[model samples]
Target chain A: MAENRLDIRYVAHLARLALTPDEETKLSAQLGNILGYIEKLKQPDVAGVEPTAHAVPLINVTRPDAVGVSLSQEEALRNAPASASGLFIVPKIVE
Target chain B: MLHRLTISDLAAKLARREVSAREIMQSCLDQIARVDGRIHAFISHDAEDALAQADAADRELTRGVAGKPLLGIPIALKDVLAVKNQPLHCGSKILDGFISPYDATVVEKLRAAGAIVFGRLNMDEFAMGSSTENSAFGPTRNPWDIERIPGGSSGGSAAAVAADECIASLGSDTGGSIRQPAALCGVVGLKPTYGRVSRYGLVAFASSLDQIGPLAKTVSDAATLLGAMSGHDPRDSTSVPQPVPDYGAALTGIKGIKIGLPAEYMIGGLDPEAKAAVDTAVKKLAGLGAEIVDISLPHTDYAVATYYIIATAEASANLARFDGVRYGARVEGADLAEMYCGTRGAGFGPEVKRRIILGTYVLSSGYYDAYYLRAQKVRTLIRNDFLQAFETVDAIVTPTAPTAAFRIGEKSADPLQMYLSDIFTISCNLAGICGISIPCGFTSAPRLPIGLQLLGKPFGEESILKIAAAFEQDTAWHGQKPPL
Candidate 1:
């Protein structure tokens, strides 16, 4: 289990969430409880059963190469919150 | 006239030209106008556009074309689905004004079948929580009891069908979003085999687990919707290319079918009333000439833990796309980094942020093996347990939820408790099987509906539907409507 509070901070940073002190405390406890519950998986016995990733047996379902309709620039830009020159415009990246 | 009709009945009417597609769409719009304020099932209603589509269907019928099975029927799209030219807020403030450029494959199929896309229904902020309370727009109230929630993420779709706002609605089930709400609202919900339906235009929550299905008032209606919506879409790589079964043909009989009841699901922690209702349902199935067997899914208890780690970890990665750069809401700041932080922080609800953080942590470098990898390994075990159980049974039955829908704020504070609401339904997703939740019996407390879940082997939706249709035929459980 992840015991350190700093770990929560690090994860929060990765997620880009700014957590208040109170939120950090609450989340730590909640995450701890969840981890404690997950620890139950350590007790289940599976001697030789191989882990199965997907439920279905079949795989490699591929489609033939075909051309498809692409959305018109005007249609695509219709929903943009901010657009310029028929393109999605974003805030400047560099100073 | 169309308000009380199921999708199949509406189809029959459309086939006979007794009602034009425009008439059906108008009726649904009228119903929404009358009752939607109280139910709040829809976040966006496009009455004119729906009516125009209906007009086109009417024109097709007039030209003597063989109308599609769903021709002229009105259906609701969960806000999570991308409907072309409509704002797909996904019940979040961040994407408040974002409209989709193209239709989701399911939506496209529905339109091609002459079904009118009426509106976008409410959902949890990106389908995260069990209760619709996570919606940035207010929670959808249960049509049965105003004080309670319609079980959520897909709550709006379920509530809409229950309230007769739409004949049927499309909802995505990741961790029981469709079935739980359907159970709570006394409707029918089907979670098709994973990748059975295309997830092409769905905003990702947990990509591996998320599947869009239907919620309707009857099993046949759900089957109709499922049949119309499912197909291999090249846009979605995970979508299966298997032949689409005639879902309507599966409703024939359940005689001699073997149904398994996992002993692990029947133990402690289930609400007594809910359990009794499920027991009664099992007895009814047995009485209908179906054989019932006690089966053990030994890894059932670990499903919740395994599911959270995998789902959240996938969610963390999938949701990283919403960094305020492309579409939707963005909070401005001095620099790109601050803008990204401010945008996401302000845009996502608390639950979404919490899960994203948890998911990110689990998938982080050092912790990956301990959490994400182990969860994946256990997920394999979970899937194997189902595969092993299926060797002896045609389908497995359990309660859709451990308890009936609680009050709006009941489990909001405790995320674990909230996650447990999907305990009975999540394993089906993990195992990549088809499952359905149809109203089984009513609980004694609020007299809210209890759902009996039937889970079938992978791509075994036909068997599950056969059993569910059998149960519906023998009992009035599916016929009972919630008093709004």
Candidate 2:
């Protein structure tokens, strides 16, 4: 594993995920193997190469912010696991 | 027999008034009832809804609304695509209770073309895995041999087509998901050029890499579906504004085309028999007057590694919208943060979680340049490699997968091994080129099907589709059905 390879717990935390202890151990080894193999990218000196964000490039794709027929509140909220009064509900913060 | 008919054939029958649309729907429904119990290709489908649409289509035909392509044909969609008022599981526990409020652009087009749109085929959770084993709902068994895996995340789509459950099915390809399974299942699959089809309402995996395409029994049927499904949509910002050509008309003799065979794709883990089949396919192409030349895609070895980094990085960001506060299944927690964690942790499958971890690590502080940025730079070189090669050859040919479909548990334990198998398929996505897999031959011992892949330049579906149609028409491989 690379010396600076990320800790599995830290990665899960950053991604807002929670893993059991066994999952953490297994994932650490798995992720370590993946990152170790990725060290091959270092062989090429891409000092001046511009990164490709899109495969077939797109440039300045924007549309006017006009209101169109959008999903109604009832339709959108129908799939919500927890909703009340036409709004999504989640656990409370700020006690 | 109706299910066995291609979309083109079925459309012709509908126009001739030889069969009612309801009869076509009943044939698909009967086939599903007969075989889907063992294959498990569909996650969900409504017979009543399908029959209802078919009855309406029959009425339209009676009223002189005929000759529309794909009319009264039944098509299955990979679970990832949204069909209005239908359950959109996406083969995961996360979106278990969710129902799509509107149709995907493709689904809307299918309805307008008078096709019965119903079945939600199983897939790798969020289209992540090479084998459907990663699905939270159980793996889809290969129709060819019940013990083997159907190559995924479009395994169900491939299997459904092979089993004659639907006239055709749509599958999204990121890294050989559509083609590999299509090859393994003895079916025809086409991954259209990136942006050839709009991605509107398709669940995002790696948005930049994802392309929706077709899997069917014949190349003409795939072409028929692609022509109807593809076009620019304001709903998808990345959709190219180019007009979709009549792909069926592109089918012609391949007398003078130049085809490049990358020497690398034949080596390494490729089974000898599978390799021989592709070699035979190359000979066939050459005999048809296509100039077959040896070409080197020097960066072939690095595609898997590069794909893992770029695809996962994008996935980690794309999946962030699935937190518990909004729609989708959620688990209760004391605080807002806990709710988000609990929901995702329980809802996602192991492979999905692993990718999320891998993705988050690469994009985080201290390692972003080492992994994410470096991978993107390497991605450019891979694309450039293909672009340079296309100048010499009109298309490139290779084996769709390293070997025939392995047993279900074969590579599931090792993430690296699973990721490595995507080698031949991933580069096409990285380069944003079109590719297709047609049944070339089968392995002798296992009797498993092998796929021959022909990749095209950007927006060059016409060239590859023409070549595939020619090869398919001459060979009996695509006509052979699995013993169900």
Candidate 3:
């Protein structure tokens, strides 16, 4: 069995996910199993191996800085959960 | 019956002026209405809009505009892609009610080729699960056996094609999402070499791993779709600037090509029937005058482990944009933090939440080096293993999945077991190469379809397509349809 190193509640908090009691219990067990499986990564001798972020090498992919057709404000706001006068509405942040 | 025709067949008929695009669209809509209740291949489709597009295609055909390959074809898209004025749900509740204002690059290309695109097909939430059971809407059942899963997260794409609900469809493969489902549902699916198809409007699951490809009735059909879809898009910088090759012209034969059978893939856990099918496929290729060489991808065992860490870590960062403030569903709470937590807690399904948490755990400050960084380094080893094997062989052959489609609920309870469902197909994505799954054979009594996988080097899609087309030509497996 793989050792349980995952702190479910803490991780959930970091991910901005509020978990129910039932979900907390289930996720704790399932993620433990997955982490145990992931422990296999330690076995590979990856000493001095360069980490590959992208499979195909991409460097300095720049295009001409010119204006192009852009989405209208109405179109951008069309799908927002709450919008008023072209601005998306979010829960209050200031106390 | 027109809906049952492959893209190539439909194209030939349309060119001969024997059929109109509207008729083809009607035929597909009829099929979807007929079998979709059982297969659940589509989340939703706009019949009126599809027919309108088809009518326009007919008008274009009347003008004698020839040479467009996908012209008059009715294609569906997995729900993960953004289609203009269409709902863009990644089979998750978080994206409910969200409609894209613009088409994805692949969708634009398909439109340019004159395809009548409609339907938001089902998939695993955020392209996360091996079985479509994780979809927030519902699971897409296999056409072969309604009780079993259509391998995911491209389940709906593969299932729709198998049931003749669409001429063909586009699917995004992050792990085995495209190939595994194609194997289970008995269709042709290809994951183009990474960056071969631009990911401009694909809802990001794992940015580095996500790729858009095709699922179709035959290898030639897949080749047609890939040709229409492949190109460099200035919008997606990761897209390769290499000129697109005419893949159809490369389907001559594999007379002198050397195909490799990796020893690591024939593991003990592989279903005996699947092994037999692949063994026979190798022999058939050998008989076709292709050399069969034994090869080893030594780091194969670590693939699933490497994939889980890197994919989930990337997903954690990518999916962070789904806060309730911007678009889609929202849940109210007291403050900004509470709203974010509450919305995510309510919106995401079990699998999505589990992965997000797992991803967050790996990328957290203290554990970053131990988990995410190590996994990335190990990924280098996995990629090297394939590069080393490709040195002596032009392509590699294996079973697309370890077994045929299992029951819908069979592995859903155990996330680890579900993760293992992708063991055979995940490494291809990790290696950033092209691969295809074609129907090879079927299991007896309560029969299910099995698939033969062909892997090609980066940008070597033509070689694998040639091999797949040849194998498909000499065999009757691709001709068999489900009892549906």
Candidate 4:
């Protein structure tokens, strides 16, 4: 449809999502259809236009540094799937 | 019929001692029990807690608490907004069994207003999709016609309001999520200007576009909810600092207001019945002594494409926080990378996965300029188009969706077709303006509700609400309930 079929495995890997074979096949086709629709923008001339990240222009918003109520460690990790010793747990990364 | 009372009616009755908060709560609970079996609008509701809150509201009412506007009204929260101690699943398997440790800012505001917040309604995962069909939990059937879909990802919110499961509900709109479903289900849905309401607790879908607003049975009811929920929150920097007006007071006849009809919104392929309804609405506006000017938003066609790029890119970044370590359901593996991959692989639904991949692809090296940046630039042009049109018109009018609610699974197979379902509503989000969808008319064959969307200038909700209220006052659409 476009230049090249999306490297579904590559993009999924970059997104840190593990997809099964069936999902990859189904998604590739769906994405291809969406991208083709998006290609319609080629007809518009958007040169020299500022990219809008938000609806309104935002400046660097800063607040005065002050101490305030902070969540207790237990409250912070209340929803953690695995935790030990007042901290969130994850699979061992270092051997 | 306590469940059928408008928020204002309920508040007035509670103040006059004509009804107690507990009585109203019981009535809603009973209604839910009788109807929810077929509607499934709710994911989970704590009846005991809801009643407890109602009891507390009664105590406050007896104690002569001066003025708590929504002191005892039952309001449903779309699953994405985190309510303290409530399971915030966001209609996704990824976050199942997770309880919110704290209330989102909106939840805090609602509690302060004395509203009895209850029930987490169903939605498309992360507020994606045009229909509730994208929910990992089964789709929420339309209350209007059970065989048809409740437009989504705020489908459940609209259904609950239409079916009187809750007096009014809060829903988040990223791109027609609030209004489309409200339109299809025959209720009033408002997507406030992007920053008018705080986004402190709304689960991020597309950060720039996502906004939290109200869905209610009437324009005034929607106004009541908005007044209570609006204001600047330090928790959300984007929350506008301007004083929140008494939106309810703003409701009045549009005696001589200027309205615009954007020609671009009325192109061919629009459903003929919907077109007729909007045309009639324009005539009615003219009859009300309102000036109707023909306007143009030339860049309308590029909105869907621009939205997909910007929303997907932002969504990819926001959803990255869902890795297994912090919270949510997890899958274990030998290593950290494997754990992340395994959990995400299993957790996210197909539609979610497709979006993440598309987003990632657009933001990837070498493609950033070609896709993401171009879309943003085009987004500015679209915004400019609206700003120019607003110079003469107080607000613009259009169909909320191209058609009435279609049958469930109708567009599920074609994602592109589903994306186009929001064609008329997407530009408002891109421009960061406010909009509302009110039941304007209906289609006869299967008898589905149609909506008239009013687009307002940034923070110009009062203008649209007044126009909508006036239109609503003269019309009978807002009063028509689903046959259910």
Candidate 5:
């Protein structure tokens, strides 16, 4: 668990949040508490338990071979905050 | 006339032409206008479009065309589902102005079946909380008791069905969002087998666990809705290619059927009143000629921990799409990074942000093996426990939730306590099994509705609905309506 305020800021940055000063203080405490609780799980012993990710026995499930049309460009861009010619408009990336 | 009728009853009326689809749609619109203010069940409604569809259905029926099973039935969808031309806000201020230009696969199926898609209903912001209090719009009050919560993420669908704003509604379940609210609101909720229904346009919360299902007043109504809503959708990769069964045919009789009682679920933390209600339900099932057996699901206690790690990890990745870009509300800033931060920070509710951070931490490089991997192992153990239990019994029965609906704002401050509310329902999703929650009885304390859950194996909805229908027939629990 992170202890210093700076370390907390680092983790918050990783999460993409720009925390306010008060939020930094409050979240540091809350995250520390949560980490402390999570530490309890480390105590459980399992000498050779293989890590399991999926619950059911499943392989890649595929649909039938059929052609289907996807949403049109106009439909896809209907909800965009800003759009150019058949594309979503975002802040310019290049200098 | 349509307000008090069940889906099956309304379908019968439509088939006989005793009432036109337009008439039923009008009744639903009138009911929504009357009760939606106090209930807050709907987020968006298109009366003109719905009436137009109803008119089309009526025209088809007049030409001696039967249309489809759900023809002319008015249904409300959770806002999480995409409906073309409607603002699918998903109960968040961030997506407040976002409108879907295409329908979700299920929405398209419903429309094709001639069902009048009435409107989008309210829900927990991004389906993150057990109570609709997490909704950015506002918390949906329980119709039964205005002071208590209508157990959520699917609270809007549950309350809408309970208040008769719609005969049936579609809600997605990721750890009992559908069943918990349905149980509290005195309705029938189903969570189909993981691959049984499509997740194409569900607005992914926990991709593996999320499934859209139905909530209705009767078991048969839920079955009818499920049959029409399910099938192989090429658009949804996880959808099964198997033929959709006639769910109505399965509800006939449960004579000499086997029902398992998972003893672990009946132990400590279960309200005594809830236990008594379940006990009475067991007796009723036995009287209907079904054999009840005490069974074991050993790893039930670890369900919540395992569920959080997996669900949160997926949520963290799934929610990454919401940075101030393509659609929805965006908070702008001078730099790209700041824009992303500002938008997410303002758009998401507190619980959603908390889960995302927790998920990110678990999946982080240093903690991956310890938190995320270990939880996955435990999740396997949980699934195995259910598989082992199924070998000895056809279906497992337990209380849907530990207690009935709590007062709104009661557990909002304590996130851990709120997570535990999903303890009983989470395991079903983990195991990739199907389950249903129906009103069994009422708690004596505040007289809130208590739900009885039945878990079945993969594609075992037919068996589960049979048992639920039997229970419904033997008792008047489903008939009792909340006085709004």
Candidate 6:
């Protein structure tokens, strides 16, 4: 196994995911094998090669400021799991 | 039989008043009723809405109004693309009970082109897996053999076209999701050059890598669908302002085009039957006067590692919006943080959770420079390899997947083994180039289909469509239907 094995529980928390104990065990083993295979990336000498974030070079695109027709408040809240008075509802955070 | 006709043929019939659009839609609905029970290609479809659209198309035809190219065609969409008044689950439970209030840019274009966009096909959850097994609904079976998988995450799209459930369907590719399944299903699939099609309403998987394309029964059908679904949308900044080409007209011939064959792709793991199929396809291309040159893409081995790092990193960020607040399903907890974790834990499938964790770890503090940055630099080398090869050859050719479709559950136990299935197709997405897969031949024993992949340079859809059309014209492979 790779020496820098991932802390699955911590990573899951970082991703805002709650995993069962069985899931954590299985995922850790699978991800470990995948990372081990990825260690081959060290074989390539990519000195000074510019990283490509987008395959096509794109400039910061901006459009002219104008008021355009937009979705209605009703339409926006239509799919919300819980909403009231044109606002989405969620659990309390800073009570 | 009307359901089995290509888009071009169906359009001609509609134009000549030989068949009504409703009749064509009825044939498709009937076929879906007959075989979809076995193939499981669709997650849901609105038959009443489809008939209504067909009737509207018939009215236009009756008035002698010049119809749009895709007028009256029955097209399905992978669930990842939003359609107004339709459920958009993205093959995961996280999106439970959500309905889209607006159409994606591609959906609007399809509607504008007079296509009846109805069914939501199955896919790997968040487009994460190589086969459809990760779907929350259920896995779609291969049309060729019921026990085998339809290659995914566009498995349902390819299988629907193969089984003639609908005239054609749309799918997204971020790494080999579109072409791999198309290959395994023995149909035509095209992944246009990055920025070739607008991604404005697509659920973000890997924003930098995701592209929407067509899967169809014939190369020309794919061409027609691509034409309808392509062009610049000011809404998507990544959508290039390049003019859309009449791809249907690009099918002239490949009399003198140079097609490169990368030496690295003929690796040890490649199945012999698939290898022999590709070899024969090369000879067929040569017989049509296309020059086949052997080339080398030295960085081929690093693509899967590079793809997993970058794609998942993007995915981790894109998927953060699925938190319990705004839309979709929510599993409430005592606090906000607990709600977020609880909802995601209950909603996401095992594959999706694994990817999220891997992505979080790679992009975490102290690890970004090692894994994420290194992968991006390696990505540069991989892209350069394709660009350098394109300088000499117009396009490259390879087997779309390493082998034919395997039985379901064969590779699902091991994620690494499953990832290797896309080894031959992922480099195209990393390079931001256009690629197509067409049925080349078939395996004899179980009688499964094999695909030959042709990849073109950036903004080079015309070249590949032309080459694929020429190859498809001379071969009868695309004409063979699965023994459903």
Model 6 lDDT tens row, B1-484: 9999999899999999999999999999999999999999999999999999999989988988774888899999999999999899999999988898889999999999989999999999999898999999999999999999999999999999999999999999999899999999999999999999999889999988999999999999999989998998889999998899899999997988999999999989999999999999999999999999999999999999999999999999999999978888899899989999999999999988888888888899988988888899999999999999999999999999999999999999999999999999999999999999999999988999999999999989999999899999999999999988
Q: List ranges where model 5 is wrong by over 4 Å.
A: A1-8, A22-52, A55-58, A62-67
Residue pairs with colliding backbones in model 2 are none
The collision pairs in model 4 are none
Candidate 5 lDDT over B1-484, as tens digits, reads: 5877998898898888899888888988898898889899887799898899899988988987764888888999999998878888888887868888778888888888778886888899889999999998899989898899999999999999999998899999998999999998999999999888877778999888899999999999999888888988777777777789999999978888889898789878788988899899988888998889888888787777778888989998898898868898778777788888898888887777777777887787777777788777777677878888888778888999988999999998777788878878999998889999999999875778999999999889999999999889888999998886
Candidate 4: list runs displaced more than 4 Å. Answer: A1-4
| Retained true contacts (fraction), each candidate | 0.53, 0.74, 0.88, 0.82, 0.36, 0.84
Least well predicted 10-residue stretch by lDDT in candidate 5 chain B: B233-242
Error of 2 at B240 (Å): 0.5
User: What is the C-alpha interface RMSD of model 4?
Assistant: 1.7
Better of 2 and 5 by TM-score: 2
Error of 2 at B451 (Å): 0.2
Error of 4 at B75 (Å): 0.5
For B1-484, candidate 1 gives per-residue lDDT tens digits of 5876898888888778888888888888888888889989998798888889889888988887774778778888999998877888888998877878888999899988778887989999989988899999899999888789999989999999999888999999988999999999999999999989999999998877889999999999888888999988888888887899999998998889999999999978899999999999999999998999999998889999989988898898888778777777878877776777788878888888888888988888777767777777788888888999999999999999998879989888899989988889999999899899999989876789889999998889999999999999889987887775
Inter-residue clash pairs, candidate 5: none
Supply the global lDDT for candidate 3.
0.92
Q: Which lDDT value does model 5 have at B397?
A: 89
Model 4 agreement with the true structure over B1-484: per-residue lDDT tens digits: 8998899899999999999999999998998998888988998899999999999999999998977889999999999998878899898999978988878888888889999999999999989998999888889989878999999999999999999999999999999999999999999999999888888878999999999999999999999889989998887888778789999899988988999999999988799999999899889988987899999999999999999999999999999999998999898998887889999999999889989999999998878888899899999999999999999999999999999999999999999999999999999999999999999999998889999999999999999999999999889998888887
Inter-residue clash pairs, candidate 1 = A52-B380
**Regions of candidate 1 where Cα sits further than 4 Å from its true position:** A1-6, A45-67, A86-95
Docking category for candidate 2? medium
Candidate 1 interface RMSD to the true structure: 2.4
Which CAPRI tier for candidate 3?
Answer: medium
Candidates' RMSD to native: 1.9, 1.2, 1.1, 1.1, 2.3, 1.1
- Every prediction: chain A TM-score: 0.70, 0.89, 0.91, 0.91, 0.78, 0.92
Instruction: Please give, as one word, the docking class of candidate 4.
Output: medium
On the 0 to 100 scale, the lDDT of residue B478 in model 4 is 89
| Candidate 3 structure quality by residue, lDDT tens digits, B225-322 | 99999999999999999899999999998999999999999998899999999999999999998999999999999999889988999999999999
